[model samples]
Target chain A: MSTTTTAPVDIFTEKIERGENIEPRDPMPEEYRRHLIRQISQHAHSEVIGMQPEGNWITRAPSLRSKMILLAKIQDEGGHGLYLYSAAETLGISREEMIEQLQTGKARYSSVFNYPALTWADIGAIGWLVDGAAIVNQVMLQRTSYGPYARAMVRICKEESFHQRQGYEIMAKMAAGTPEQHEMAQDALNRWWAPALMMFGPSDKDSLHSKQAFLWKIKRESNDALRQKFIDKTVQQAEVIGLKIPDPDLRFNEETGHYDTGPLNWDEFHRVINGDGPCNRQRVEHHVRVHEEGRWVREAAQKVLSFEF
Target chain B: MTKTDALFHYCLRLGDDAVILGHRLAELCSRGPFLEEDLALTNIALDYTGRAELFFQYAAELEGKGHSADDLVYRRPERRYYNHLLCERPNVDFGHTIVRQFLFSVYDRYLLEELGAAKDTRLAEIAVKALKETRYHLSHAADWMVRLGRGTEESHRRVQQALNDLWTYTGELFEMDDVDLLLLEHGIAADLHTLRALWQAEVKQTLDRAGLQRPADGYMQTGSRKGIHSEHLGHLLAEMQYLVRTYPQAAW
Candidate 1:
């Protein structure tokens, strides 16, 4: 343990500067762990609650294949939340506490999830854009400074790619199908496009968490940078799928080599994040209902396990 | 239409297969033996239903049928449906439910992979997407198969008994008649002969892992592929089809 002659802060500073991953056992500032837990837990809650919108379409999916993919994607999201919560557990936070925070509305997930998955195309759009943007964020998080979170991201990124691909394929088929099908695809994209942009979160200038998060290497890049990257990648992908992205002002400027998009509706974003969106109360209420309904099942499992032990 | 139109019918057949199985599983919605398993079952059921919707929608388009997915699912009479009898059978208990899911998921896994190679673009694309989901379902069911099969004497014995009782129904899944023959000619449906061996290998391996003996595979049942069903389908449809039949214009 004493083999190195480096001072504590100096070693910490070097690790942070080099973007080396920090483990639970590693010595780091308490603020770093606390911040990671806060953000990661919020991310976990988002994944968990995110199940609702698409879940509504589970029984109503127009085809067996779509139902299966949607189910897998939702189940995968639950697994993802478990992984993230487990990672946060390593940071010395309790799962119950994080869940409590989520219930109390003290934590925040991605605001995009607050919107409902209203149709089959909404499922496609979510997979193509919402999950697509999430993959972008998660792929970067795979290189994040927390070892467990990074490892979790590695697994999540692999599954999320399939989700994105299936979603894109869905949109491709619809775009090439009859006019009605094309309209459904366009409608889904219109509804989801802006929310997808908001998923990257507030711009760097307005983001209070970005600097400390960036400095600690908890976040790989600034919010604005990630948002821009997502925008650039999505624009071309949308074109290939033959769907109209809702942003009327969205364009590629050859001069700056950047996408020029319309202003983000921060007001709506804030309202949704603050639990004022159309589906916010319904989503949470449903989550609670299901949880309560499953109480007996959890008890039965516990009962069976006890006998085995 | 050439045999290729059979591909369209074949897609509907696959869709109907999943939808029926999903509906059967959904019957266990609040009755799961345990919570996690309950959620898992419903999740799997939802997956099947979603897959059915995709196949049905595509099939409707291919057939030039004016029917929407809802219309195909709710408006069809029982005799017009094409699902195997095994999927429509009621879940007797946890043992029976798990056994059904375990066997069917293995079959689906193999079948979907073969369908992934279909010459028809829509079928191929649908299978490619569905194959991934089926793989997960197979793995999940396999895990439970091993757990329940090896966990306790009661679990082991009950699951084995369930397997034996349910064995006959499996034969219907491979029964290829006019629709199957037609789809095969068009490269829409997978070659069932090839899929059978893979399904056998997967189920056998999982049974072996769980320390469960293979129930004798003799005395397999048939006729369900030809629109024949067990007594359960009528009861199932009575409940499931009731809402839409009664409401007619209900939306949520």
Candidate 2:
């Protein structure tokens, strides 16, 4: 009933400010929509690219039980990716375009995945540290303003905790086992510690999108705050399992009741984000190769779908 | 062969097939043509891995040698593995994978149905549970068979090529040795010979719908029952057993 078309932006802003859920059909600022699309698609891409490192170990999982667990976990990651892609589709972007963006390096996934899963213990480290960091961020996103994204986060967090537990179990078992296994556990923690910290992304002070995303309720917590929470929870877990935190300067600050750590390697984080990490090229290349190889199959599926209609 | 020995071999064959094929499918995890297909392949992989564990556990118990399922899966040498050669065929492409899966699942579906009613209650129970899963596996692979065969000209060509290449391996699935003859006599195993005709009919029906040609039966591959395999199995086992073999005393 408003005479002016400009009133919808005011209404959308009011709805966001009031912490109302933004349904797919709800009026929203274009910037808010774009931000959600970008954020959600990147999250989805991380879920997918995250599979490669863990998938690397499925064949040599040391035991039948371990192999099955790893395969199921990776399957869940793929399912999460599917759910996230569907949620992003509600924002009006096709999965094809998003994939194109990923392959072309226009979009980014978690830089943590750009590192290789070098050994079997690396799998445990990934599930524990990487997924643990992700849970902290996703738990906050479950309260995000977008209804579909929030719902997807809710389901994903349940499985992520399971993945985290399995990973921690692996770490614990190895940490308590033979000397070689203990070494393997410690080495994995060493390699993964910094990268896992980087998973929360750049500090909020330097993050270009953090301010707008926070104002829109697309992101509820700062990267540094989430990183601190992950560290606080994970340090005790590592201690209980007998694995050392890789940080030399990490200490418990009695004043703040928080574990404070040395400065993160933002240089390496930026390097990985900019496509210079060990597995960045390999990851994207493999994805592109698989996509290209399946072109005929996807076309066949489309053709069959058409025939059915 | 005694009935117990025959049953152990039967379970080993079933377990080996599941684990080997599951390994091939797991290798396709992130390599699927798309995300949905990726998840589908891995889901099937997980199912096969689970089924493999059940079969191996039963086999280990029957062996009564203080062996665990992990020992049967990770400690066995290549020549000792009794999986059908078909299951160990490399996943060369999506067409190859689907064709291989479709071919094997048809035979597996028929085998499990008969095994589900076998006189051996434990094998029957496992088979009944597995039959439910095989039903889905067969349908999924069969659906893709039609899509790929009736899809693009390239897809049709690729899939036909895959079928032609893999046709020789199918004969091994129906081969019966002393183990099968003994188990069949006790009504503890499904008669592979009897299941062959039903498997053929079901496969032919799917192939017809997909417009795929039934490849000519030439020199059908054999020797898996005799512990002989193509070169692929050794490499597959080497990678699969490396971790457990490397640290024999270490607990995972």
Candidate 3:
């Protein structure tokens, strides 16, 4: 609000509006710094937390090829987490601090991960749908105003395209497979459909952070816009694979040339995000346990790095 | 004494070792101490599974009973799995896992080298393809062994303890039975015991480089070659086969 600071703030905002990036060393508003750090770290946490559900299927993957695909996919999520965490670090927060925030439940990852992957078909559903939504959201964020986050988003979007396709391929096979397989695929789609939608976050009116984030060019699309895009593309794909999407109200809108769907359970979404989802506690607890148990190994590795070995 | 019989069994053993170890590593997928290491371990596991599939497919072909690879991996009882006991050992900790991988990779490297030169073109071709992966696995696992051993007091102690505990199972990696002997006579299989000295030397050298001592080798454990394994194999198989067994009609 100070006269002197207003000029620099205007310049920063103007650069973002002009479609240019703000480097880490550039003078940024404290609010902008905090927002970037929070969003980027949460993004990183989602990737890290995302590994658990898919990893559950790695050992039990029915085929050699599927097993590899699942393993590679989970590994990619781990890699994404590293990239995003490193990206967040450019905003001046340490990786340990962000991880601590996650561990203490002081911060949140994607609430979608709070749902358990109960069956192998869920993997297919996730790769196809969850990743599908992420791709839409990420494609937009690739133009984010922050340089490192934008660059990281570019790399992630590249890898994520394959993830969604691989997932769809699994769904395609199951849908064409035996009756039991078709049923499993349908069940997976049923369970995952709403969740994948929720990954775009709440609607515009309900998303408290969206206005500021959008103003800062951190998110190039509203949650609703990205969700609409994902829903439009995904509904047809489900039909092609002979799987019924869970949304009973889902239909293509001829007038708008977009898919119209049922209302989301914002209460359930809030509950899950507020630590009430089925796997929310389990996921956080697992992360905490690993961090605690891994302290010695990390310390040992660090010691070697410090040449104290 | 039939070549097909010995070759079929030899290939099954190789496939079994790969899949079993691959299963163990796969279990460590999300539980890795760190992200990069998690990816590294799973990448190696992917190689193991890939190698397993190749060997299993070849074995199924040699068996000539229309048995698919799934039957070999999922339908078999624990006692029918001929993986080296070291692989069947649980990944008790990072140190133990590293030591186990180091020992197995050393044996596997030399084994692949000899097999790469087999007179049987198909087996030789498979070996030549697999040796590349095995060499990489050995170097990665060996480097970890050195780091963990030389890293700190805790890592050093844990890794040395792993070496002592796993030393017995190490002998089984080089155990050759009549099936192997029969294949060796016709150059369809390499004599596993021939690689024992090289394995020992490499292991010793790696441990020494890590500033750790190799445990004295005595009372070597054997029986995996005879389809006998530790209790751990059954637990692994239970989880791995659950989907296939519970839903015989299921297709992944």
Best by TM-score: 2
- The reply for model 2, stretches above 4 Å from the true place, is A1-6, A206-208
Q: Which order, best to worst by DockQ? A: 2, 3, 1
Selected candidate, larger DockQ, 1 vs 2: 2
Using lDDT, give the best candidate's number: 2
Tell me the alpha-carbon RMSD of every candidate. 8.6, 1.4, 2.6
Candidates 1 and 3 compared: the better one by DockQ is 3
In model 2, the Cα lDDT at residue B230 comes to 97
TM-score of model 1 relative to the true fold?
Answer: 0.66
- Higher-ranked by lDDT: 2 or 3: 2
TM-score of each: 0.66, 0.98, 0.95
lDDT for each residue of candidate 3 in A71-104, tens digit (9 for 90 to 100): 8889899999999999999989998899889988
lDDT string, candidate 1, A109-206, tens digits: 77888888876678888888988889889989998888999999998898787888878887887777667677888999999999999998887865
Residue-level lDDT for A243 in candidate 2: 88
lDDT of 2 by residue, A247-270 (tens): 899999999999999998899889
Q: Evaluated with DockQ, which candidate comes out highest?
A: 2
Which lDDT tens digits does candidate 3 get at residues B1-252? 688988999899989989999989988887888778888898889899988999999999999999888778887888888888898899988889889898988888898899988988888888898889889988888877777877879889999999999998877777677898887788777776668888878888888888998788789998888877777788889888887888888666
What is the CAPRI rating of model 1's predicted complex? incorrect
Q: What is the interface RMSD of each candidate, in Å?
A: 7.6, 1.3, 2.0
Considering only N, C-alpha and C atoms within 3 Å, which residue pairs clash in candidate 3?
none
TM-score of chain B of each: 0.93, 0.99, 0.97
